[model samples]
Target chain A: MRVSELVACTGVPLATVKYYLREGLLMPGEATSATQARYGEEHVRRLGLVKALAGAGLPIPRIRKVLQLIDHPDGSLFEVLGQAIGQLPPYLDIPADPGDYPRARAVLEKLGQIYDPRYVAVAQLERALEALEDAGIPMTEERLDAYGRHIRGIAEVDIGLMPTGSAEDAVRCAVLGTAIYEPVIAAMRRLAHQDIAQNFFQKTDEQDAS
Target chain B: MRVSELVACTGVPLATVKYYLREGLLMPGEATSATQARYGEEHVRRLGLVKALAGAGLPIPRIRKVLQLIDHPDGSLFEVLGQAIGQLPPYLDIPADPGDYPRARAVLEKLGQIYDPRYVAVAQLERALEALEDAGIPMTEERLDAYGRHIRGIAEVDIGLMPTGSAEDAVRCAVLGTAIYEPVIAAMRRLAHQDIAQNFFQKTDEQDAS
Candidate 1:
C-alpha cells in the first residue's frame, strides 16, 4: 500500500505517519522507487499499535521503548514486564538513601510483598504515601491492605487477559493493558465515589429538605 | 508567620510559592509592610493541598479549579463532587453525536449506574473503550464489571476517608483524595501484577529448570 492507502486503512493522518517514520516509531516501507515506497501488512499493524500506545497516554520515547521490547523478545516475561513498568512515566526523584520511605516499606512488608528498592512503582508508591501523610491523610496498614486485596483481584483479571499466542503478544498485552486500562479503572473509582456519595449525601440533602 | 516561615513549614520553595501566588493557586498573604506579608495556618494547609495535587500530576488549571470548589462551598456535597470530577485531566475529544458511544453507554447501563452525559469521566471511559476496541482488546461487559466491582470497593474506602469537619474539609478530601490516591492505586495495581506474575511465571521458570 502507498502512504495514502496506509493512512486510509489506519485512519492516521498522513503527516503523523510521516512523523512516526521519521521518529523511527514505524518501520520504513519497501523501496518501490526513489521517491516512493510500498507499505505492507506489518506497517498497518504497527501503526495501529503505535496509535493505541499513544492513546494510552505514553510519551513518544516510552512508546519507542515498549516497541523495542515487543520487537525483540528476551524470552523472559518477568524481565520484560519489569522493563515495561520502568518505562511508565512520572518517575519521581528518590532520596539518596532508601531508608527515607518507611511508610512505603512498612506497607509492603505488611502485605508480605518483596520490596525491590529498584522497582519504580515502589518508589512512586512511597512518594505518594509520603505526600498523603504530609497532607494529613495517613494510610493505615488496614487501608493499604484493603487496597492490596482489591487490587490483587483486579490484577488477576489483568493477568487473565494476557494472550497466550506468542511472547510478542504477551508483551503487547501487558504493556497496553497496564497503560490503557488504568484510566478506565481510575474513572470507575471516581464514578463509584459519585454513586456512593449520592446515595449518602444526596439522601441527606433530601432528608434535610423534608 | 512570614512567607519564609510558611515556606519553611510547608517545604515549598520561595520561588515556587510565589509562583503559586502569582498563578492564584495560593492566596495572597496579608500585607504587613511594603515588602513583607503574613501567612497563617490556613496558608500552610492550602500549600500542602497544592503540593499533594501537584504530586498527583494535576496541572495548574485543574488544581486551581479544585481550590475554587474548596474555598467556596454552596453547602451541596453532591454538586461539589460533580464539579471536582469535571476537573480531572485528559478530557478526550468526543464525537459530534452522542450516539457514537454505544459501548460506553451499554457498559454503564449494564452496571445500572445513571449515565449523566455531562460527566467527563463517562466520555473518557467511552474514548478508552473505543481505543481498546480499535486495538483489538475490546472490553467485554464482564471484564468492565470485574474492574467496576474492584474499583467500587476502593471507592467505598475513599468515601469512608472523607473528613466531616466542614464543607471545605470534605471538598479538600474529595479532590485531594481523588487526585493523589489514584497514582497510589495504579502503582499498587502494577505491583500486584508483579507479585502475581512472579507467582505464576517465575514458578514456571523454576519448574522448567528443574
Candidate 2:
C-alpha cells in the first residue's frame, strides 16, 4: 500500500503519518522511489497503534518507547507494561502529605495488598491527598480506603476485558484499555453524574417543585 | 501573606505563581507596594486548585475555563460540571472509525441506554471501538455493554463520594475529584492490572517458569 492508502485505511492524517515517519516514530516503509515510500501491512498496523496510544494520552516519546517495545524481538509483556507506568507524565507523581503516606500504608496493610509507597497505587493515593489537601477538600483514611476498594473493582473490570492470548496481545489490550477506555470510564462517570445530579443537588428544589 | 509566603503555603513555585498572576490565572492580592503584593487565603486556595486541575491533565485554557466557572456567581454546580465535561482537550474527542459510530449506537441500544450519538458516552464508546478495531482486537457488543453496566457502578461510587452541599461545594468536589482523583482511579487500575497480570498473562509464563 502507498502512504495515502495507509492513511485511508488507518484514518490517521497524512501530515501526522509524515510526522511519524520523519521523526522515525514510524519506521520508513519500502522505498518505491527516491522521493516516495510504499507502506505495507506493518505500517498500517503501526500507524493505527500509534494513533490509539496517542489518543490514550501517551506523549510521542512514550509512544515511541511503547512501539519500540512492541517491535523488539525480546520485549516481554511485563517490560512494555512497566514502560507504560514508568513513563507517566510528572504531574501524576505529586508528593503526598507526610500523614497520607502512613495512612495509605495502613490502608494497604488492612486490605492485605502489599504496600509500596513507590508503587502506582501509593503514588495515586499521594496525589489524591495532595489535590484534596491543596483544595481544602478533607479526605479521611476511611474515605481513602473506600476509594481503594472501589477502584480495585473498577480495575478488575478493566483487566477482565483484556484478552488472555500471547504476551504481545495481553500487553496491547492492557495498554489500549488503560489509555483509551479510561476516558470511556471518565465520560461515563460524568454522564452518570448528570443522570444523578438532580437528586443530589435539587432535593429542596424537588420539594418546591412538588 | 506575601508572595513568598504564598509559595511556601501552597507549595507552588514562585515563578509559577507569578506566571499565573500574569496570565490572570491567579488573581493578584492587594497591591501593598511597588513590586510587592499581599496574597491572602484566596490566592493560596486558587493556587492549590489550579495545581490539582493541571495534574488532572487539563490544559491551561481548560483550567482557566474551569476556574472561571467556579468563580462566576450563579455558576450552579451543574454549570461547572458541564464546563469540566465540555471543555475536554481535543485528544479525548478522538475521531471514530466510519463503522464504529453505528456499532457504538447498536451497543448502547442493546444495553437499554437511550443515549444520543452526540452524547459523550457514544463518542467514547466509538473511540473504544475504533481503537480495538484498528489494532485488530476483537470486541463484541455484549462485551461493550457489559463494560457499560460495570462502569455505571464505578460512576455510582464516584458520585456517592461527592458531598451534597450547596452548588459551589458540589462543583468544587466534582472538579477536584474529576481532576485529581482521576489519576487515583487510573493509577489504581494500573496497579490492579499488575496485580491481575500474574493470573491473566503469567499462567502460561508461570508454566514456563516451572
Best by DockQ: 1
Backbone clashes under 3 angstroms, per model: 0, 0
Model 1 ranges off by over 4 Å:
A32-36, A59-61, A92-101, A206-210, B18-37, B57-64, B92-100, B206-210
Error of 1 at B205 (Å): 2.9
lDDT tens digits by residue: candidate 2, B1-210 = 998899998889989988988888899799999888898877877888788777667788887887777777345565567565555543445334535477566655665553434445557656666666665664666555555666566666667777776555666677676555555566666666666664655675878899
Q: Give the clashing pairs for model 2.
A: none
Ten-residue region with minimum lDDT total, candidate 2 chain B: B89-98
| DockQ by candidate, in order | 0.70, 0.38
Write one digit per residue (lDDT tens) for candidate 2, span A97-124. Answer: 5354764555456666633355555666
Q: Residue A134 in model 1: shift from native, Å?
A: 2.9
> Residue by residue across B1-210, what tens digits does model 1's lDDT show?
999899899999999999999999988999999999999988999998888777766889988888888777554777877887577676665445657778767777777776455677777778778778888788876687788888888888888878877877887788778877887888888878888888888678888999
- What docking grade does candidate 2 earn? acceptable
